[model samples]
Target: MHSEVAQLFRYSLGFIAAISFVACLCIIALAQVFPWLCGRRDDENAVQSMHSRPTPRIGGVAIFFTLALGVVFAPTTIVQSYLGVIIATTLLFLVGLSEDLGFRVSPRRRLLAVCVASLVVIVLLGVWLPRISMPYFDLLMQYWIVGVPFTLLITAGVANGFNLIDGVNGLAALTAIGASVSIALISLQAGYDTMAMVSMMLAAVIFGFFLVNFPFGIIFLGDAGAYTIGFVLSWFGIAVLIDSSQVSAWAILLTLFWPLADTVFAIYRRSRSKKDAMAPDRLHFHQLVMRGLEICILGRKRRRIANPLTTLVLAPFVIAPQVCGVLLWDHNRAAFFTVLAFLAVFIASYLVAVPAIRACRQRPQEA
Candidate 1:
C-alpha cells in the first residue's frame, strides 16, 4: 500500500512538471505572436532604447495565461488552498499590463494595488505563518497581527525588487530563477506539496523566459513579467514559511536575503538623501556591475572576457553565500545570526569594492 501510494505521488508530480514545461513553451510562442496580432508593435519601440534591439516586452501575458491554465488543471486540493495565488497573480498581471501600456500610474497607486493583492492571498486565502520563533522565546504569538503587515510588505517588496533589478539583461531573470529554485527546494524538503508545485511551475516558466532574456537578449520580462514573477515568488516564500513544520521562520529570511537586503538598503539610501523613498535610481549593485562592464567593453579590451567576467565573477561571490547559509542552518536563531553576519560582510565588501572599481575607471586614458 505504501509503495503504491509513493509511486502514484511521483507520477502525479512528473505529470505536473511535464505540463509546466509545455505551458512555458506555449506561452513564449504566444508572447511572440500576440503583438503582431493585436496591432501593438509600436510598444516594442519603447523598449528598443533600453535594450540593444527591439524585443517583445509583453511576455508576462503568456506566463500568466499559462499559469492560470495550470492552476485550472491542478488537483482540487492544491487549487483550493492556492486559490489566492491564482487570483493575486492575475491582479498583478493586469496591473503590470496597465503600466506597460504607458499608463502613468504613480508609485502610491502601484503600492496600493500590491497591498490589495497581498491581502487577498494572506488574509482572505488564510495563507499566513501561525508562529514565529524569537531569539529566546520558542514560539512567539501575535502572528495574526504581525503576519498581515509582514505579508503585505514582503509581497509588495518582492514585486518591486524584481522590477527595480530589471535594468540589465539576464540579471532580474537570473535572480528570479535562483529564487524560484530555492523556494521549490525548500518547500519540497518541508513537505509542502502545493507550494512546491507552484514554485516548480514558476521556475520552469522563468527558465523559458530566460532562454530569450539572457546573452542573446531576445525579449524583456517588462513590468508584467516582473510583477507576476515577484508576486508568485513572494507568496510561495510566505506559504513555505507559514505552512512548513520542518522549516523555521528564519530560514525564510535567509532564502530571500538578497532582495530583502537590497530593498531595505535602497529605502534607507533614498531616505538619507532626502529623496522620495520610491524614486528610481541606478545605484543598485547590478547597475554598478553594468557600469563596470560598459567601461571595460569601451576600453577596447576583449568583449568576450568582460561580459562573462562581470556576471560570473561577481554573482557567485555575492549570491552563493546567502544560499549556502539558508541550506546549512536549520535553527531559527542560528540562521538569523548567520544572515546578520553575512550582511555585515556584504556591506563591508561593497563599500571597499565600489570605490575601488570607480577609481579604476576614473583614471585618465593611457597616452
Candidate 2:
C-alpha cells in the first residue's frame, strides 16, 4: 500500500461526493412526483417517532446506487480495490432494504445476515479485529475460533447500534460524518491509503443523505442506510487496525463510542425491565436529549424546531471522542483510558438527564 493516496483517487473523491448528493435529491424528487411508486413513506407513529410528516425512507437505495455508479465512472483502480468488501455487505444492505420497503425482516434474520457479511469480509478481505493490547485476551484473538466470533460480534453490534440511533433528524448521518472523517484522518496518518479514501467517500455518501434528512426531515435514513454506514465504518476500523501496527484498537473504539455506548445502554436499560432486547423504545441517549429539548426548552409544539436542534445540541458530545481518537490513535494506554472516561460520562449524563426531563414533563400534568 502506498503512503500517498493515489492522485486519481483524490480527484475521484469529489466525483463520489457529487454523485451521492445528486442521487439523494433525485430520490426525494421522484418520491414527490410519483408518491404511489416511491417505495415506502414512514408513518412516524412509533414510540420513537420524532417527525410529523410521512417521508420517503429509502435513502439507502440512492446511496448504494451512487456506490454502484462510482464503480463504473470513478477511477476503476480505486473502486475495484474495495469491491469484495462492498459485495460482502450486499446481504446486510438488502436485508435492511427489505425492512425499509415495509417488508418484514426479523431481527434474528438481520443479525444472521450481518454475521454472514462479517464472515465474508474476514475471508475475502482478510480483515478482522486484531490485537487490543490486552494481555491474555489479545493472544486468544490469534485463533480462528475466537477471532471469527469477535469479528462477528463487532459487525453485528455496530450494524444494529447505528440503526438504533437513527431516530432523530440528522442524528445518525452527522455522527457518521464525524466518524468517517475521523477514520480517514487516522487511516491517512497510519499510511493506509485505500482505507482513508474509502472512508472519505463514505462521508460523502452520508452528506448527500443529510441534505434532505436534517432540519426539516424530507427523507428518513431508515434501517438500510444506518446499517450500511455502521457496517462500513466498523469494518473500516477493523481493516485499519489490521493494517497498522501503530494504531490502537482502543482509539478506533473511541471513534465509534457514541453508537456503541448508546446501544449497550439501551440493552441494559431494557433488560433491567425484562423487556425484549430487540424491542424499540424511546430510552436511547439521543431520544432522551431530543425529548429534553422538547420538554424544557422547545416545548412539545415546536417539533420542527426541536427535532434538528437536538442533533445540533448533541453533536459536540458525539464528535469529541472521534476527534480525540484521531489524536490518540497510536497511544494505546491513553486511548484505552479515554474510552473508559467517555463511557462513564455518557452513562452518567443519560441517567441524570432522562429522569430530570421525565419529572419536568410530569410536573405540569401533576399541577
Question: How many residue pairs clash (N, CA or C atoms closer than 3 angstroms) in each of the candidate models, in the order given?
Answer: 0, 0
Top TM-score model = 2
TM-score of 2: 0.93
Model 2, runs deviating above 4 Å:
1-10, 33-42, 72-81, 365-367
Cα distance off (Å), candidate 1, residue 312: 3.4
Q: Tell me the alpha-carbon RMSD of every candidate.
A: 4.2, 2.3
lDDT of 2 at 226: 85
Residue-level lDDT tens digits of model 2 in 1-367: 4524566356766777777778778878887887742344544666777677767788887777776555554334556546776788788889988887778788788888889988888888665788766779989998888888998998788888888888888989999989998998999899777778778778877887787788788887877888888988898888788889899999998888899998888889889999998888878888888778889887889878888888998999999999999999999999999999999999889879977997989988899
Off by over 4 Å in 1: 1-52, 72-75, 135-143, 297-310, 317-322, 365-367
- What's the true lDDT of residue 141 in model 1? 35
